[model samples]
Target: MILLLLTVVPVAAFTPWARNDSAAYVFRDHVTGVLEKRRRKLDALRRKGGDAIIRDAVGRGLHWNALGVAFPRDARDDAFEKFAQTVVAHQPVDRAMLRHDTLAGRRLTAADHDAMRSERRRLATVDADQIGATGDDARNSRRRLAAHDAGRLDATGAAIIDDWGLSFENVTRISLKAHAALGREARKQNLTAGVVEATLLPGDVAAWLASPRLRAALDAYLGAKAYVRTRIGALRLTNRLTAPYSGAEPNLLGYPSGFWHHDRCGRRVKAFLFLHDVKADGRPTLIAEASHRTHYYEYKDLLQSRFSDEYISSNYDVVQLVGPRGGGFLFDTNTIHKGRSDGKRGRTVIIADFMDTRKLYTFKKLRYRGPCGQHRTVKMGGEDIACQSWCRR
Candidate 1:
């Protein structure tokens, strides 16, 4: 069972401007473009080995250190050279083609085409580096790509290019490593074999939090600060409780915030609590089985069959916790879980999201790259999707 702590922070509680406005649109557009480019390249390679041609041509003339030589003192140029090398190692032929010239006329064998496609698929699905690339790099990349595409190559453009160069380098490294991590986790979990959906409820949380008598545990755990109430559409806790120290926010998925996909790296709500009792007949939450992996589209049919809506609707899963006032349930976030609304008493529970901050920082240090874009800041149904995205399986 996956535990997700829903922090029902009223929209009005936080500063109005604290919400990110530019992120969703920009990210949507950028990611779309990146995917498109990858698709086109793969298509070209499949059709005429044109991708190979381009890579060969680019590899031949690009000069291993040309970017560095062109901008000798530019740290960005140096970073780009390093990045290019790394990219080459994974897709040596592509890197070679990108630098080579005479390879333009070279013909690829069927095996070669298959290999290229495999590499393309690998790159397309790779997760962003959790640590590589800084926020600045992402910003710079966006700035440069915008300027270059707009035909503006002034000093500002140069700076943007530098930033973009660094960003590309960072994202490439981070994404590659993250992909590797995902593969390892998948194998460890035997996910390749498949998993079945598990039913979890707020009563579970309450049972865990309750004592031998199964009464409210608020007085024991939360003391006097704990107060239960129904507001908006769900039950919630209003007081603050002490939490273990997690490191500076996680930057999983190469985004500034650590909330783009589960398994990327960061502290996430591992368990959820249901405040009300199950016999109360509350709304049911929906959890998608086998939805934890990146292949979200694969689960579309399953979601449509199960829910009134399709497309997984939003990245965030609404969960209902039903239990006694002080009882709660706990579970991991790695599982696909959601709360459903049967229009009954919205289950109420004290929610707690936890992450191993130390592990998060360690992952960051292992994969840290320069920044390239702003952290994700999109909201859906008054909840932060960025964090949910990170928790996405």
Candidate 2:
């Protein structure tokens, strides 16, 4: 059987926050004209401490635990072969659309597949250290990160890459375009920006995954040629109606993403591009530095569960993901982190996910995928759906 780590549970089994999402969402923006009461409720959560906020989340449901060990090979050999064979037979890696193209729509050549095959073995050898964790002692991930950022060139120079080809002006232009596209998508869905994050299709995004700087960074991080997830997106976090809109659901308890959690996906790295200046004041992402190697608590229903802030903060040194408008960074999501959603000045960013080539056949299948604004019939829960993906349910 396929090791369906993130898919075995029913949707209703998800936390109450995930269940209460309405398709037509009224967002809490800085705008004074709309949704006053709703905005105040979200503001209150923003003012609260992490520990208190997390308690509200678990207050409504059971905290599930994992049945298996940490980071086990999610794809058994037989299942991987079967799925790979079916994919090769039906879709086939090619020079055109679907699985053959990059998230930004770059067509893959025979050379690309050949290169990937050569490095396929790297996928199986991944450990916490390969993706982002450093050093032997799990307790020292933060100290190690601090030392490197403070001037350990040997460590910082290896995995962190910043030589992306796009200039700040070019990126700013792209960010503007991305927000406009997301706005159109949100209006179509009757949802606003902060809560709904939509994937960028071929035309909307540029083909930068293959850029040498980024490609080399991912190769160093994954120890293999990286495979892109089909659902890469431009993320926006603004309280103003003008900041790009994407809704995940507001947990009456708390924003699920703001709580501490490690992504259960195996070995993968994500590239985050800042579209505007974000300092400590901007609602920047907070990560327990190098916490990927540490396993504080395991959950049975790991898919929809989160770790307590009290436990994570007590153990790890947390830091903000801050940078200029065109700056970017590569990170392993398995590290303990929270994507901050509360801020005064809105934030705009582009996020891309990549994994080792060998991991491509592993993740549980996405039963539905459609263009951002188009009407696509999803065979989920025996009903038609607007959108669905590995992240967007």
Candidate 3:
């Protein structure tokens, strides 16, 4: 018994699980502090203006981050123009609808109340239904349908994504009760502590899985009604208290939290729902618009180099996604993006990934009924989401 104990102890210590846990424990605090310090340094650099870090980074011609070297102005305008043209004939939104303030000590007019309610309803509707040009009222609905069937991002959806790798629109309004409950439950699971994968509680999962707005967004992006194959891949909650650092990461060792990277393997679509308001100082995510279409791995060697400013500024239109509660963005994970953290107030968001069941990461042969009432089969090594079917995967 004494000999067996001695042998097992040394062998087990070197097992993958034991080694990984030991590394995490030993490095979590040290790496986190190192990353936080880097973030503070970069934040200082950003404050120095155009001629400072940005100019220096762009001056170095080795890195490209934005849409293409020459982002055709007309192409960018055309994407947004289609959506605006569709809404051109509608009655103008009341001026009151544009006021982004809370109802505090202000006097309330009936028009003000009506406008507020109208805006709320408008925010809740999906694009197809919101626009008369594509909805039942449109004479062009049939034409739109045919165009959508061509297997690409729908006209309006394409416009947004073509201009940027992601798009933002308010799709759902969770009740205060539900939103609070979600936070409470997430806190109970201590999801904020580390980058561990987790699933939402059963109650939260059902609400998200059955979200009509999410379904609509998927259909719009797919240009066809898609069947959600998985039980909704893990609903991750990230509290960006310790945002990933942006620095010279030679490898994972000096890599800051959430370093600039894209999800590999396929074109994965994810919905990020912010449970509360995310202001500029609140550690909003920074995404390089339309970076998904470029070859991301080309900059691997430069990733660890000292051109941190270039990685952020060169051709990349970095968008700091700041918005009100219930507002969020749907994006292709293949895009270059990262969460920002100042260690100030953290934000809570639920992210759900959607993809065709056939491309889901699983080894076993599996069959299941999708949310869209279609049966899907997962064979090993199936076709993945290509650019043509940006929304389907």
Candidate 4:
């Protein structure tokens, strides 16, 4: 572990400035901090039967934390899960609803929400519904079906709608709840990222998950109810470069977050809500408009490293999601995007991901489910999410 830590932590210095650093001392400090954080996480993941889950995860080269192993879930989670499964959409949303919702009193926006237009597929088309990536499962989505989902954009209903200008009585309350709950995570570890779920979510945020807007959008987009796929969504924090390395990287020690890449999450739309003001320097996410529809799951060979920003910009309209606190956008992460978080500043962003419950739930029952130490495991990005149809290993 020490050798591995030494190799990765110091190498980051060559990439970009993360907070401040005096290579003479900060390197060792970063090593200590990172190891300590991993030890803490390992302790938590190894608790109860969590080790079994960890073994299952590591054996498959997966991230153990996202399994949500051993994390306590109460009655509220059960209720929310049920709500997610039952809610029906009055009307289906369009291919890409680029609108912002309210969070922390801020509104998010996707400049051209309708830009993700495709004649062959709808925003909700699952991987199985279309051609799949290579070396995937046997099907690999070889059969291409023309989504056949024709719709007149429903002003009220959208496949990907966020809570930007739309304010409910609980928006502020939910924001505060998220801060209080997620802030502790940030302060405790100067966290880089975490998958928020279950008890980690405050009451208001959990209730908001069941809100008409989220539910309707999810239901319409999926053409069925959404389900909780272990990771409820992202409850990630990015600390300013003041620390040794930008922040605690407990999730994926060196997950490439800066490059413009697709989330590899297929046929999915995630709602992002910024906890504080996010700007170009604060690691705000920069997205390529219309790429969501244009790229359409061709994520295997995507990223700014290979496909330069200049090239992508030439083909697609790049939209930087810079907004104040509470500002965020519900984007089809399948599009090209990047978060610029080199520690110039830091911010906390929570993402609410609504996955297709119909296919997800149908496959697995209570068979392999359990607390952390003994939870079910899948490859990273989850093989179950839209059939693991995206481009990462």
Best model per lDDT: 2
Q: Give residue 248's lDDT in candidate 1 (0 to 100).
A: 53
What TM-score would every model get versus the actual structure? 0.27, 0.51, 0.43, 0.42
The Cα error of candidate 1 at residue 53, in Å, is 20
Off by over 4 Å in 3: 1-197, 201-205, 223-240, 243-257, 295-309, 361-393
lDDT (Cα, tens digit) per residue for candidate 4, span 1-393: 998888887211011112221121213343335334444544554454444543443343322110011111121233222221221111111111111110011112242123222211332343323234332331222111111111111121112222343344455666666667665655676554422222233234554444333433433344332334333333543452332123553222343445455553333556666656777777566676645432121122122112334445555577667666654655554455666546466666666654444323322331211111112222212353333222112
> Higher-lDDT candidate among 2 and 4?
2
Per-residue alpha-carbon lDDT of candidate 2 for residues 1-393, written as tens digits (9 for 90 to 100): 456955885332221122122111222121122224323433454455322433333343213222111111122234323322322122222111122221112234677557644433232222233435333332243223323432311122113334344566667667777798778778889864355566675344453443334543454344333454434677766674322223463342334566666554423467777776787767777876655432222212233335455555665678777877666666666566777766766777777765443334333232212112222222211233343333333
By TM-score, how accurate is candidate 1?
A: 0.27
Q: Is candidate 1 or 2 superior in lDDT?
A: 2
Would you list the rank order by TM-score, best first?
2, 3, 4, 1
Task: Give me the displacement of residue 194 in model 1, in angstroms.
Answer: 36
Instruction: At residue 346, give the lDDT of candidate 1.
Output: 34
lDDT value, residue 254 of candidate 4: 44
lDDT over C-alpha atoms for residue 229 of model 3: 30
The candidate, 1 or 3, that scores higher on lDDT is 3
What tens digits encode model 3's per-residue C-alpha lDDT throughout 221-327? Answer: 43222323332222222454453433443334322335555543223456666656767777766666665443221111223211233445554677766666555
lDDT of 2: 0.44
**Which residue runs does candidate 1 get wrong by more than 4 Å?**
1-35, 41-269, 278-284, 293-308, 313-328, 363-393
* CA RMSD per model (angstroms): 27.5, 17.2, 22.2, 20.1
What are the lDDT scores of the predictions, listed in order?
Answer: 0.28, 0.44, 0.38, 0.37
